[model samples]
Target chain A: MPTIIFNRPDNRSERVDASAGDSVMQVATTHGVDEIVAECGGNAMCATCHVYVDEGWIARLAPMSEEEDELLHGVAAERLPNSRLSCQIKITPELDGLVVRLPDRQI
Target chain B: MSASGFTPSAGVPHMDIDPFSIEFFEDPHPAHEVLREAGPVVWFDKWKVYGVARHAEVHAVLNDPLTFCSSRGVGLSDFAKEKAWRPQSIILEADPPEHARTRAVLSRVLSPTVMKQLRGSFVAAAESRVEALLAKGSFDAIADLAEAYPLSVFPDALGLKPEGRENLLPYASLVFNSFGPPNQLRQDAIERSAPHQAYVAEQCQRENLAPGGFGDCIHARADAGDITAAEAPLLVRSLLSAGLDTTVNGIGAAVYCLARFPDQWARLRSDPTLARNAFEEAVRFESPVQTFFRTTTRDVEISGSRIGEGEKILMFLAAANRDPRRWDRPDEYDVTRKTSGHVGYGSGIHMCVGQLVARLEGEAVLSALAKRVSAIEITGPATRRFNNTLRGLESLPVSIKAA
Candidate 1:
């Protein structure tokens, strides 16, 4: 099983295991991790699940989708090069030790 | 096309259900249960449309927009087969590449950030409205609180002029009814709504809307080259279509639930913060926007059943909300239950853009009522407001006690 490391802005961290097919949004939500609102329920329509990927893992992640890219522009927090809608990132064998930094806000 | 090119009557469960009838609309649960039990995908010979009532299939179809397209129309009438009565909504009816731009504009405008900005005004309006209605001691919840609350805030927030704002309900009522077959209801709504439709159409323009409102925000995006100038009004129309009846019915459903289920009201009264969860559970228990039909762009298989190109697949969000396979004691309206993933607002890319604001409105009203009203009792039998697509009350006479 792949594990997702959610680094909360409050300086707390939650490392939870995720099913291979589940997205990081689903993992955070299922484990009751805070700060990932996922307001659109993993639809990529709402940017509430915005997260910054660990710089080391950015290249390994799937390219941001057009819809995700569009909504990312409107996220409440400052957009970063590593900023991604966690709902758009699916868990896979290669992403087993993924680290996603939770934004300070996800309004 | 050959019979082999399309879905053949093999393993598909055929149901004799008439989904559009008033009887079905009034109490759809039994019919929904029947649909779900029949199969994951059922073919309704009466309407000659495929139906998916189970959560998995309906969610799957909605998620895969490329295959189950909306551009053909999210209603009984196929736009490809006939001329649409009005301009197709660039956001609602357009496919991905066409839908993306306008949807991006709306998704941004109606995001949680916008909801946070709109929250204060919405709560203030809700507080004032609830207070005024509670003073009546006994009044119609639907007409007095539900419809009145949304009418007071939403249209004003949308930048609609206050005069002739009575036209909003009729205009929106017709829009919902137009989603079904061309029945007497649809025909009557068309006849009764001509003037209101004209007023609503006029309100969609950049000049007609207030300078600093959501409408202007949308047009500003157009000015910024996010979307074309011509697409702005159509996007406004999408907002009007999704925003009005949905919130009204959502609030109405929550109020009705609290009134009918005294224990649940007691629970909410004890913990006012459950107001949001209470509103959501009510939406799941009594789905406001019951059903929407999506057309298949090509031959598609869902849960072992095949539906052909251009065929209408009725995604029963209402049905899916109560599917026994997906919910525990699915019929109960428990305020404390976590009601995420319910299709009360539909799902996927086409999910209700009106949702965030609607949730805020519902939470505001319910929390205000919970804070002040000790008890809510239906003084008279609730009357149903019939729209082909909307499920809400015409009147709910209620008497409340002060906390």
Candidate 2:
């Protein structure tokens, strides 16, 4: 099983066994990792599931679409080049050891 | 409409009119067309808010919260200035840092996986309800089916007791009503719900919520300090505020469309898969949550209107949904219409969290109806419910022929 780690400011950490085809958001949500919202249910309409992909992992994830980019503008946290809507990024076999940080807010 | 006369600081489109009056509320399409045609940005004078009526502009405003902040609050009355009768919601009101934590907890608990697990139960409930109504032949769609379905499943899923759940509609109505002008509609709902606020708050306590439900998960997050315990029920209120009336309105609208357009109903009956699309198209035709307010964070220009920082902006979602510029033959109800990107469930960060639940409930009810009812025809005039934000029917008498 692939593993993904979540970084929270309070030093809270969660490790989820990412299902082969699950997005990081899906894996986090299914396993009770309470650090992601994904309020739009992975529709790429809401930025509630926003996360900052580490530089190394960014190259592995698919590029963002117009909808995802548009939604990112609404998120509360500071948007960075590495920031991506987790719903838009699916976990593949290639992303075996991914690490992502949760934003302070999804709004 | 001189380009030089347009000030970037006053992005006020020319057609800032009151949308809540009887004439506009009864039929806002003509005014909406004027607003859209006048400019992309329109100001609502009575509410003292600027707004976007054009489809593309509405989507743009909804998608850009940084420029249009929700941190102040969604309602017309600023909670920060007023002593809000109830606690504020972490997910609904707060900006990023605070908003993120609550959303995380809610998302984790109400994940699609969990929803899939509950699908069978929801479908069963929907089927049984539809079957019961179909057997009756003639029934009010709002009271009988649309309101009944979510009023049953959503509250039960929250572990709200029989008595506690009674506050669902009134509480939600006031919550949404308060988002509009502070008139009789707002006052009436608030006064009715004021007494129950304490009880509503108490329900969020750990002891009140039964285990293995979304409400309990909210409390669990409260314990984790992701959200305050006080905020739990209020967040739960967001579910209630958003869940019941919207879904009820949505289902009512869909059923109304089916009755008004028999061809669409026939298509849904033959092709059961069209049920989902049918519901969405109905939502497009009549947006349930008609409008929501957002505040401008900085000076912004849209459609030759310049809105200054901290100004209120009320985006007319229903108007935008019928934007002639965006959709051809915008008034007609056609299930086959390309209605994919409509603002029926809103857009961007503040978009509805329970939309999946709404969609699933709709599909379930429509699918069940398709199974049992060979045909449905309207027998009486459907009365529109008087709600500031919710566009729904109060009664829709329909005769259904059981298959």
Candidate 3:
């Protein structure tokens, strides 16, 4: 199991133990974490599961797909360099100590 | 004149099919094949609009709203030039910046927290409906199960008055039909839809909506300056126009699927938690929202063809869902397949806002059935309900054995 820290919109930091193959969005949704919406249910279609990776953890993640990049442009919040769609980020062992901050809102 | 004020590109492959015709509506798969094989962007000579049927092209057009705008209207008639059938949806028809404001407010109003609160009542309603249907054993799945469950629970959740609640279905039908050319279907729908449309408009008013319902919450947002007070009713109207029919068809699709594939039903019965995935797979297999229009903002090239600005491009969402280029076995209804990327809920900024609600309803009904029903078998041939855009069965005769 990989431990991921979710920095919620309400400023609460909750640590979740996630399975290696599950996406961060899946873990958050299954664990009842309020920060991620996952509106499209892990499809790279909706930008509702947006998260900002901490600077230190950004290098370990996979590259964004064209679909993910296009959807990110539609996010309600401003898209920062670290902004990523949580649905596209699979929880691998290398990402065991990932830290992601949820956007205030995801439409 | 091209609605976008540009000249039409010459030599685009022409197909003289009326996508809204009774024939096409009854069995659209053949027509869908024609659209896909014709070209990436073919000209519908009958409707004089460009049509895109391939999955990749449809996805591209939906993703690029700046080049293919929704502000003109997501239907055959461009709102910029023609008088709208009703007030335009501030959320659906508007582009970003303007669209962002209303969407943000609505997203919060329909957030997961709110939906979670609705789960208990919705699930109870589903269980009760399933209980009743199982007792009858052999019944019309559409009328007795699909339509009944949504009518029983959704309107009450919206805080609508019980008296004229039947109007929502016809109103939604009219709205969807208006997206196609003004054919006989559109004409008939328009005539029969007036009373229902009037009733929906009346219910959208602030005083008419029940306190503490979704409608009331939208009005409260207006008071807080999230959206204008004038826009509140229209947003409520948006919910009324879209919410019910999609879910009804979705549930209908689920039952139709399980009855058609007995083994899948058995799989669901063994693991009732697969209920949500079952509904989603059905959506992918039988896309309820078949098509929507997008207009070109400027000349853009897609699939080796240059499309001129202001052209009405009809994106076949259902066709795209089944396009071979996308899925391994696009037509199969496999509940375990990862169906996340399907356009059953249209992609991009204008994706269906009520999808979560629809999924919740489907999950509730299917979960109840899986827990209580051991098997679902089709007792008779399912009859199709022909709408211009939605694909659903009017009656599904199913016999279920109680677990």
Candidate 4:
């Protein structure tokens, strides 16, 4: 199975196995990754499942859409250039070992 | 609307009991278990509508909003066939694709981010309320903490003029009860809340709300062309309509659960982070917003029983939460239980739009009390306030022991 790494604000990290077809949000929620509150169930209706993609993997992932861009502005944390809604990032085999930082608080 | 021409299949169980009766509301558990065991679809002869009590059926029905539409109204009175008592809720009574647009703007406006911003004020209010209750020594949880906490904070969050803050519960009573059969409960609530409806309508206007509050954020969406300006105020109405009494009842239910189940209280006391989950469990256990109606867009079959087109199916969310088929210990009040799939918040796209708000409010209050108070002892009876659609207490006299 492909895997992803979730780094928390406190400098701790969890490397978890991810299913090939699942979104990063799905993996985060399934593994009970803390503060990954996909409140609107990943409709992009809520921007709670925000993550800061590790720089090296940013270009390797799918580009953000207009909806994701607009929702990013509404996130509680300071939105960075690498900020992405995890629900919009679908996991692919090539994206294994992808790293994303969880926001300190989602709500 | 009456299901006069329609009929249910012989496979569906028939019930003669009134689900709206005060007697049923007072002790609904036995009836709920019977409804769940009866069949997937049970026809309540009193209302002449089908009832879906099992978790699977309720989940499936709510998920397939396309087939079981809300456009006809989410109440016994069908909007398609008869005039509604109020302008049908643009959000609650609406279905996609329009429902999608309105829901998007709403979910955006009241997202977790907004709750983050409101967290400071909400927690402060919760802490202050706890202090007041402690000073009083003994008080009704309903009047003092449950109702008082939300009433103090939510109106300020909405930025409504403080004078008519009292109108929220009456208006909410009218909105929720209107979903049921227009019996004495519905009629009485409607009569008493007429002026209150007018009062709330005025508050929904953009000019009446303070800038940078929940109403303002929604209206900002209108300016950006996400939703119509006309739809903005009504959407704000949606928040007030669903947000108030449901939350008040939710808090009351949590306090009642902790008081009755000492072990659970101890569990919550040991770890304050479980406060949110405790509130969620209480909501699952109590099922505050008891039921909703979904008019069938087409003939539907669930588990083997058939329900016809234009028929009303009362989705018993409370009953579904307790269905033994769903939870490991459906009757037990355990704060640590995983309550993710519970229908207490409803299900599918129309799931409670205000859930994030409810969670924030529930957590703030629960965390505050769990930290300051050691025991929540029931000193007097916890009286059930009967409404056609809501399950809550009118009074819960309790004295707390300081930690």
Candidate 5:
């Protein structure tokens, strides 16, 4: 099991266990986190499931899908170097102990 | 062409594939290819409708309400006395000033600030649901999570007790299905949900809505003479019907896409920030709400196809999302596509008022999952739940081994 830590803007954090083969969005939606939307049902069409990966972890993940990259174009919040869609991210052994920071708000 | 040259069945010449139907919804690329070849708009006589498979025309109709009036209803049924049950969505159906007023009330009541204020409660409820689903390890993403989440959140926020909430799904499903022809699908939904519409309506009454929620707020606006009392319940009804399924379908669609692209799913886990973009990309790719109809308010020329006044014009959003002309490798699900201009939430005045809320719900769920799950993939065959207008999945079975 990968240990996923959610750091909110207020600096509060919740640590949860992410099972292998589970996409980040599914775990969050099923577990009840407040910050991610996973709208478009995790299809990368709504841009609501955005989160900031810990800067250090960016390269460890696979490259962003063409579809996920395109949908990020007009999000209201500023896009950072570590921006990603939770649904696009799937937990793997390599990503075990990964830490993702949540934006203060999704809307 | 030999059978191998094209799809095994349906010898329709030059037909790529039909992704909207169940047989093809899972993998619609072949059908999209055929529609793209046919032209910007192809009249599918079998479905008795024209498909605007190209991106440009689909976007045009989605954005231009004047040419593509929504008053006739966005479904296949004429919404005539024989088939119609509920009234049209004034906010979704009217033009300009009328639409402007109803939308304004909904906006004032369901504003970003208001939704944000409810974040704590929404998050708490979502967490409980997530915990239950996560415990199961393998479950149906649609019924177990997506549909269950919004049905739990919105009604409570609207002040409905748990008992009053039972009708939400059936009512919304029927309302959206009624947009199609009065076929078995429509008939089944009607018969199933018919008994609940009255109860649903009763809950929307001014006296019934719990104070402090959005429903009460609308009633307050009516009292202030900002809007007619007659309009309050209808607007609330609109919120109930449109708000729930849209988010449900949206969430469901994203899950389906992620399952199809393991690389993309892995990318999302590496950096949860991409979750928002991932959702938008899914909508652009699958278009949960596939098509919205409009009656030509007057004579109109759409991409050189003359549409007479009062003629029904169906806008094919799913086709447009995959249109090759407007996108590079359009069929591929790339999160980086410039999807801001996409018409997934529609355009013009009738754009979804509760979009912020929907986005918030999506972000909360995905972000939480990113922090917990290590790997997620489909464990069983995914099934699509068909509705005339809602393009969404019925089941997405995934296997997870917690990290």
Candidate 6:
């Protein structure tokens, strides 16, 4: 299991222990974490699950798909180098302590 | 080649069928086969537009909205070139930045927290409706269950006045029909839609909406400077346009599926938690929202075919959901399948905003029924509701055996 830390917009931190195959968005949705909206239900269609990955974990995460990148271009919040649709990031044991900061809002 | 010697950009096929015809609406699978098999992108000669039917192409087009913009319009009559029948949707018809603002307000207003608060009331309403219908033994599923549940709950949630609430369906039907070509279907819908359309517009005014309702919340956002006051009513209209009809048809699709496939009903009955998946599978198997048009922003290549700038590209959402290249045994109505990626709800930025409400309503009704009903059997042939875009049963006669 990988432990994912979600730093909320309100500065609250919630740690979720997720299995390898479950995406970060799925873990947030399943555990009722309010930070990630997952509006398209992790389809990478809507950018509601936008998050900023800690610089250290960025390289460890899987590469973003073209579809995911295009969707990121439309995120309501400002797009950053580490900005990612949380749905695009699958949990892995090697990246056990991944940190993601939820945007102020995911439109 | 067209009369102008405009052959589809190299290898892109042309189709002459009227996708809005009653025959096509009744049974679209064959036409879907033709569209998907013709090419990834095909020109609809009748409407002088291009269409994409394969899942991959449809998915790609939806994700890449910059190439296929919705701001001009997501219907046959482009707002840029034609007179809009009504004020365009602030959310659905706009591109990024403008779209992002309205969408953010809506997403925040209808967030999971709101859904959680709405659940108890929605479930209570669903249980009551089911109880009443069960007492009848046999009934029209569309009117008795599907239409009845959403009509009761969604409107109340919006804090709409009970009077003239019947206008929602006709108004929605007209809105969806307007997305297709200006044919007999759209004309007829327009003629019958005047009064209902007026009623919908009137209800969107700030004074008409109740305090603490969804519509009021949208108005509040305007007051808060998040969105302009002028944009407020249109956003409310967007909700009125996008919310009800799809869910009614969605529930109808689910009931129709469960009745037609009793084994699936049994599967749902055995594990009542499959209620949401069952509703989603129903959406996949019998897509309620059949099609939406997207115009090309510039000449673009899709699947090795070039579509010219400003050309309309009709994305067959329903057809894409059932595309064989995407789903194995796509036609089968199986509740247990992992239906995460289906395009039943249109994909990308313009996806159905009220889907969570629809899902909650579907789960509420299906869960209540699954717990109380052992079987759902069709008593008569289901009659199709003809619409330019939406596909659903007008009447589904069924008899349920109580659990």
lDDT of 5 by residue, A1-107 (tens): 78788887789888888899988877776666767765444535456678889988999999997556755654446678798888889999888778888877665
Of 3 and 5, the candidate ranking higher by TM-score: 3
Per-residue lDDT of candidate 2, residues B1-403 (tens digit):
2112233244355454677765677877788788888777765546666667888998988888788767777766555456655566667777765666666666556654566677899989998998888768888888888888988798878777777666777767777787877777878887787655666666666677778878888877788887776767767766656777788889988988888888888888888866766887888898888888777667778766666776777788998889888788988887656454688887767677777677778888888888889988889988878877888888998888888
Going through the candidates in order, what is the number of backbone clashes in each? 0, 6, 1, 0, 108, 0
Residue pairs in steric clash, candidate 4?
none
Q: Using alpha carbons, what is the TM-score of model 5?
A: 0.73
Model 3 Cα lDDT, one tens digit per residue, B89-165: 89888997698788766666665557768989999999999999888988999999999999998888888988988
Candidate 5: which stretches are off by over 4 Å? A1-107, B1-29, B46-49, B79-83
Candidate 6 residue lDDT tens string, B148-179? 89999999888788889988998999999988
**What residue pairs are clashing in model 2?**
A105-B96, A105-B100, B11-B305, B11-B306, B11-B307, B16-B43
Model 3 pairs whose backbones collide: B4-B310
Query: How do these models rank on TM-score, best leading?
Result: 1, 4, 6, 3, 2, 5
What are the TM values for chain B, all candidates? 0.97, 0.92, 0.96, 0.98, 0.88, 0.97
- Predicted candidate 1 versus true structure: per-residue lDDT over B42-139, tens digit per residue: 88767778899999888888889999889998998889887877788887888898787788888777866677678899999988887887788999
TM-score of 4: 0.88
Error of 1 at B401 (Å): 1.8
Candidate 4 local lDDT, B1-403, one digit each (tens): 2366555677787898799998899899999999999888899888888999999999999999989999999999988889988787788888988898898888777765677788898999999899888888899999999999999888888788888787889889889999989899998988887798899889999999999888888899999999899999899999889988999999999999999999999999999989988998999999999999999888778788867778999999999999999888899999987676688888888998888788889999999999999888899977889999899999999999789
CAPRI-style grade of the A/B interface in model 6: incorrect
Q: Give the TM-score of candidate 2.
A: 0.78
Number of the candidate with higher TM-score, 5 or 6: 6
Q: Which candidate do you rate higher for DockQ, 4 or 6?
A: 4
- Candidate 2's C-alpha runs over 4 A off are A1-107, B1-11, B79-85, B223-225, B228-230
Best by DockQ: 1
Q: What is candidate 4's CAPRI-style docking category based on DockQ?
A: acceptable
DockQ of candidate 3 relative to the true structure: 0.11
Per-residue lDDT over A25-78 for candidate 4, one digit per residue giving the tens place of the 0 to 100 score: 889887878568775555565577899999999999988986688778778788
The TM-score leader among the candidates is 1
lDDT score for residue B355 of model 4: 87
Give the better candidate number (2 or 3) by DockQ: 3
Estimate, for each residue in B1-403, the C-alpha lDDT of model 5 and write its tens digit.
Answer: 1211222113323333433355655555566667767665555443444456667777667667766666666765454313447776778767765776777777667654565588787777766776776788888888887888887788878877566577787788888887766666778888888567987788889788889888899889899887898988888888788879888988787777777787877887888877667878887887877777666566666566544555455566776667667677877876545465466776556667787677667766665566567767788877778886787877788865454
